[model samples]
Target: MSTVTTRTVAYPADGLTMIGHLALPAGDDRRPAVLVGPEGPGLNDFQRGRAESLAELGYVALAFDINGGRWFTDPGEMLARVTPLLADPDRMRDIGHAALDVLLAEPRTDPDRIAAVGYGTGGAIALELGRDGVDLRAIGTVNALTTGRPGEAARIRCPVWAGVGSEDPIMPPAQREAFTAEIEAAGVDWRLVVYGGALHAFHHPPVDQAVVPGVGYHPRHARRAWRDVVDLLDECVPVPG
Candidate 1:
């Protein structure tokens, strides 16, 4: 079994409590750290599972919640809940920046080697954080709706890997193509994976509700995305001393 710790971190004077799950490498040493952002406003079991899996791979990982403890079971409900927060990019950056501060303060985390991975909406936030000049080493996002933010792409300092499904409507081909071009223009090392016949939330293994008639889960893409996440971390975040 992997070792893990659940902690509550308060954002800087924001009066909102963010829940985080930290998974430590076996036998203890300051290790490279990853902040795994959940897809919804709050976190879910799949996000926690990713953290545990990362710990199994010998990196310190933290799965964080954007909203304080509330989560929506349905997609519509989730959109209604996070719409306001999503509209405000500055607030979104604050949320990520605060989390980075907390992670940097962790004694067991290697401040020099920090990266972030996010799924769906959370991936959008990770992109914002990366684009806002947060000192990340690597960034990996899965099934995200790519949006434009001013000066965001130019500020990214690390390698980026983005995954998208060919069948996902939320992230259409045109949008991903445009986003890829923007990323390339920023002069940052980046890779884009277009998975065949998969839908949104491909990395969320336990998500059972089908958003459409015939598309839901793709285990192959999910597993491959997990491996890609690991590879990105290994490339960007060095093992702690």
Candidate 2:
């Protein structure tokens, strides 16, 4: 395994200081970069680990924060913080852009070859960035089947890949249909993978905190989803050898 270095980064968004985890691969050459967004609760170890794993695969990865670097153990607290953010697309874009700036500032990042991968609330933010006309090479999201404002998705210029559990109540069939319809209407290249018999947050590992109803961890599907996201990045933003 190549040596991957990680560091803490702080940036401002939504009138608060947000902390992000940045991981760099062991190479001096410019590399494809990825921006990682965490679930609603906040950026946790799982997301940070994902950034590290991407770096190990020879990409510059940054796991950006959504909630001022705080993690919520209570479901109500998590929803309280994330609900308002979800309701406002502009706010989501502000957050996403701030983190993106941090990623682009790194010398190792090939600014022209960058992608975004996010989970849950973070995933929604990634989508918002695409809708905001950010020039991303690719976008990959999990457990987030959110629709953008009317005609906004037309701004997206990259391929998008989304993964969701079939049984996810938060992103039910109707929501998924709406999301796909919007993407299709915008003429974006997109793909959706439905993991059978899984629930919301299936990509997450078992956490010590109390989660809301209908969210559970599915180990097999979690690994599979990671592989799929990696494949998406490989296809869309390959690093030169």
Best by lDDT: 2
C-alpha lDDT of all candidate models, in order: 0.77, 0.95
Best by TM-score: 2
lDDT of 1 by residue, 31-138 (tens): 888888888646877777788888777677887778775667676777776677777778778877877777787788888888989887678778889888888889
lDDT of 2 by residue, 1-241 (tens): 4599999999999998999999999969999999999999999888899999999999999999999989988899999999999999999999999999999999999999999999999999999999999999999999988998999999999999999999999999999999999999999999999999999999999888986789999999999999999999989998676
Per-candidate Cα RMSD to the true structure, in Å, reads 2.4, 0.8
Residue pairs in candidate 1 whose N, alpha carbon or C atoms collide under 3 angstroms? none
Query: How much is the lDDT of residue 163 in candidate 2?
Result: 99
Off by over 4 Å in 2: none
